[model samples]
Target: MNTKRLSNQGGESQHQMTARFTNKVVLVTGGGSGIGRSTALAFAREGATVVAAGRREEPLAETVKLIEARGGQGSAIVADVTRGDDVVRLVETVVARHGGLHIAFNNAGVLGTPQRIGDVDEATWSEVIAINLTGVWLSMKHEIAHMSRNGGGAIINMASIFGVHKSAPMYGAYAATKAAVSALTRTAAREYIAQGIRINAVSPGPIEAPMSLRPGETEAQRAERYRETVPLGRIGLAEEVAAAVLWLASPESSFIVGHDLVIDGGVTI
Candidate 1:
């Protein structure tokens, strides 16, 4: 098994992380940065051959480079989840190159312009729904088709705390899409579990990422907001969220299905 010490993403410094995904092939979307990058590295450190996919190649390449530096194996694939053709090709390429896909983290998403429901532009609304909602569906559509017939797999869709419990007024577009993702996760889980494809979701709030910060807000302001809102008194780390994704994708969560695991520092509690 491949072992490595992961750092820089909020964790115990340079501790050895054992392999939990030996001989598995994992695919991570939106893996160029933030939570996606962290999850991709985690998978690699745990002995999975990771394929990091995103619309951009540079950031994905950086993710691969980090994984390699940690003595893990990874590769970058450029694909936009918002496009059906891209998603299809993305899945095919991963399987073709890696032999088979045993796990997937559909984490690609966008935070559309935050505005009052009535004031949000059509373009912004459409983009949010397309990338955040439709994109996940497209990813599952292909992944399910592949995993069902290829001995099954685990799929973790990235949801949000906004969808599971609370929502601010201007976050309508993003919130709606996330809520839909939760519903979609349940529906897909029911449809695919019999075939051995275990589907689940991870709903996070105020993680260390650009999307969690509000417009015109500084990092300090965002930190203060989390203190007021999150019961844990701080924003979550990408590595923390990545740990949840890895659990959902691992055999440790074998009986878990259609569950939306919320990692919001007790904000929803």
Candidate 2:
């Protein structure tokens, strides 16, 4: 089938002629910024009706506007991932408005405050778990419910290299939550594949997003540090991670399931 050619923000080169996500409805959690926003736009670029779900409305709206500007369909839904009711409604609303949900990126997460494992406060720990771990779980639960009954769909949860491959000082809560996301994605993939719901995850390392910077650390400092640590000698881009997510969501990765593909620059190696 022929695909429509569209212009990007920077007058960049064109996308591939094949529209892999044509007629697909995609839901991306935490679509306000970073990887979430990038993935949402990527889906839209490929002809998907994208829904950006997040707790805040402003950023989500911004993401939708960016999607629309590119001649792709986009919408924003404000919903807290930690609440089951909100998550259920988020999924239902997507279906209600778009007709069906074909892909979901459970990417809502947070890097909690820096603190040693023993020195971490309860509130911070709970908040991290609620948003990162519990949030992904709730999203998959409702998303699977809709996909399994209506036919199959794809899901990509956001994990991290910190938990899947490497860990560091003062990141106990963040690491724990990401590790759980990896495990949950693997297990859920097995349980739901028979029902036609494909699930996988991407554990990205330091990237060109605010989340990659340490508290009070400057961009130059983080870049210099990654130059020494990451084999790629630089920070990863949100678009890079978004490319991996789109591949997983597409039929290209049909045979792969329960795999937590690490997108780090050989940090584990």
Candidate 3:
């Protein structure tokens, strides 16, 4: 008989467990800034090689710098998620370099011109739908194909709190697209769970990010409104949302499938 005793130092064991992602390959869209950026860095810190993709090269490069600064492997790829061809090439490049794609954070998004349903034009509506909803579908389409080739993988779509519940007035398009994302996530999860792929979504509330606030709105106005609406009495940080995404991507969430993990500061309640 063979016997082994557990280590007495829990801290060391915790560090070892947290490094569970060592050598895994992860691809993050919109990884240049905000929640995506934080998630990318968090994955790298846990020992995964990161592929950060985005429209701008500068922010992507900055993310790579942070990853490298922490002694993790990282590379940047510039691509627009709204284009099918771009998404295809993005996955292809990751496979070419990393051999396989194990995890993906489909986080790229845009807040299309906010206009009432009566005043919004067809072009604006189409554009918002293209990026917010279709973009996620396209990325998942290619990501699933690649991951299937390698047995299995995990995918986390960046949905919003609006995906579960609607916000009235001018947010018609944004809310609709996010709700579509939730439906899409469930569909993908059902279709692929048998094939070893796990798909889930992280719906965040009004998080504090550059993209969350309008350009002309003053901080005071935004803060006052957010405080009133959020039960936590404050807006959420990008890192807080990133933590939820990390859980979805890890093995710890193996039993969770097709679920929208809401991180809304109790606003929905």
Candidate 3: worst-modelled 10 consecutive residues by lDDT: 1-10
lDDT of 3 by residue, 1-269 (tens): 01011211122332232476887999999999988988888788788999999999999999999788767789999999899999999999999998889999999998777679989888889988988999999999999998887889999998888766647467788888999999999999999998899999999988877777876987567767888988888777777787899899999999999999888889898
Model 2 residue 28 CA deviation (Å) reads: 0.3
Ranked by lDDT, the better of candidates 2 and 3 is 2
> Where is model 1 more than 4 Å wrong at Cα?
1-17
Where's the lowest-lDDT run of ten residues in candidate 2?
1-10
| Every candidate's lDDT | 0.89, 0.89, 0.86
Candidate 1 displacement at residue 137 in angstroms: 0.4
Write candidate 2's Cα lDDT for 132-178 as tens digits. 99999999999999999999899999999888688767989999999
For model 2, the superposed segments whose C-alpha errors exceed 4 Å read: 1-11, 14-18
Clashes of each: 0, 0, 0
Task: Itemize residue pairs with steric clashes in candidate 1.
Answer: none
Q: Candidate 3 lDDT (Cα, whole model)?
A: 0.86
What root-mean-square deviation over C-alphas does model 2 reach?
4.1
